[model samples]
Target: MIEIRNLKKSFDDNEVLRGVDITIHDGETVAIIGESGCGKSVLLKHIIGLLQPDSGTVKVDGILIADAKEDVLYALRRRIGFLFQSAALFDSMTVYENIVLGLWEAGERDEVKLRQIATEKLGLVGLGARSLLDFKPSSLSGGMKKRVGLARALAMQPQYMFYDEPTTGLDPVTSDQIDYLILSLTESFSTTSLIITHDLFTVKRIAKRVIYLNKGLIFFDGTPKELEQSTDKTVVQFIERFVK
Candidate 1:
């Protein structure tokens, strides 16, 4: 389980997250939504221990993230997969290399095992062709890059997957495809998923629960249906903008 309590953080003069509390149980998919700069990404960083809060705590399975030693933190992070907004792929590396890079760095030197890991993960994301494994990120489309990133993340067999703007730049069709992939993979792996997105469609399709952050606090926390049906002004206004 991931537990966050009264988390607070500030950068210089800007206070981002304020007294935020959220508890995500195992095997759940939670979507975080809000305007840009409303602290959604900031909170994600806190959860993954990339950013330490000035106050409060973020605990993963009872381990305090802020207090963990470097190795302890690394171990925790190894169990979590993150897909950055830009996909963050190394343009120079081939698809196969990208997928097995982590395992290789961790001391898996057998080429056969590395190839097997790469092939299996790529198949999970529907990129199973042996030929494409030689293609670099620079040669792939945006959606393809995201899939490769997802494939790489899955190579770790993470217990938790964090997706940052998973469908940000894609067309509606591709966006829905990505959402389907996320849903399928989450169910397949039974992994906890935390997605940060401004897309309401994705929230509806991917989230079992929706968290709306506003002014450094969670304005609403409930099912996606609840979020859409909410009568709150802020909720209505936000939805209206997306609905149009």
Candidate 2:
């Protein structure tokens, strides 16, 4: 489980997060939604130990990551898979090399085993064809790049998955494909998934629980049905603008 209490963060004169509290149970898929600059990405960074909170506690499975030792933090991080917004693949590397990079970083050195893992994960993400593995990021389309990124993340077989704007630049058809892939993978691995997105369609399709952050605070937290039925003006307006 992930527990965050009284989380706060600031950048020089700007206070981004203000005493935010949230708990994500195991094997659950949660979506965090908010307008740009509402601190959604900042909160995600804090959870993964990329950013230290000014004053708060972030615990992953009872281990306090806020101030853990480097080794401890690294160990915990290995169990978490982060799919960055831009896919973050190395442009110089081939698709197979990119997928196996995660395993190599985790200290795996056997060539056959690494290739096997990469092949399996790529298959899981619908990039099973052996020929595509040799292609670089430049040759793949946006949706294919996203799939390859996801395949890399899955190579870790992480217990927790974090997606940052998983469908930000895709067309509607590709966005729906990504959404379905996320939902299928979560169930396939029984992984705890947390997605940060502005696309309400993705939220409605995959989120079991929706969290709406506004002005650095959790403005609403409930099921998708409750979010639609909410009476708050901010909530209603956000839904009307994004839900289509």
TM values, all candidates: 0.96, 0.96
* Collision count of model 2: 0
Model 1 lDDT-worst window of ten: 123-132
Off by over 4 Å in 1: none
lDDT of 2 by residue, 1-244 (tens): 9999999999998999998999999999999999999999999999989999999999999999977999999888889988989998999999989998878987899999988888888888877865677898999999889999999888888999999999999998999989999999988889999999988888989999999999999999999889988889999898897655
**In model 1, which residue pairs have backbone atoms overlapping below 3 Å?**
none
- Local error of candidate 1 at 65, Å? 0.7
> How many clashing residue pairs appear in each of the predictions shown?
0, 0
Clashing pairs in 2: none
lDDT per residue (tens digit) for residues 79-174 in model 1: 999998889998889998998888887788999989888888888887776457889899999998999999989988899999999999998898
Error of 2 at 36 (Å): 0.8
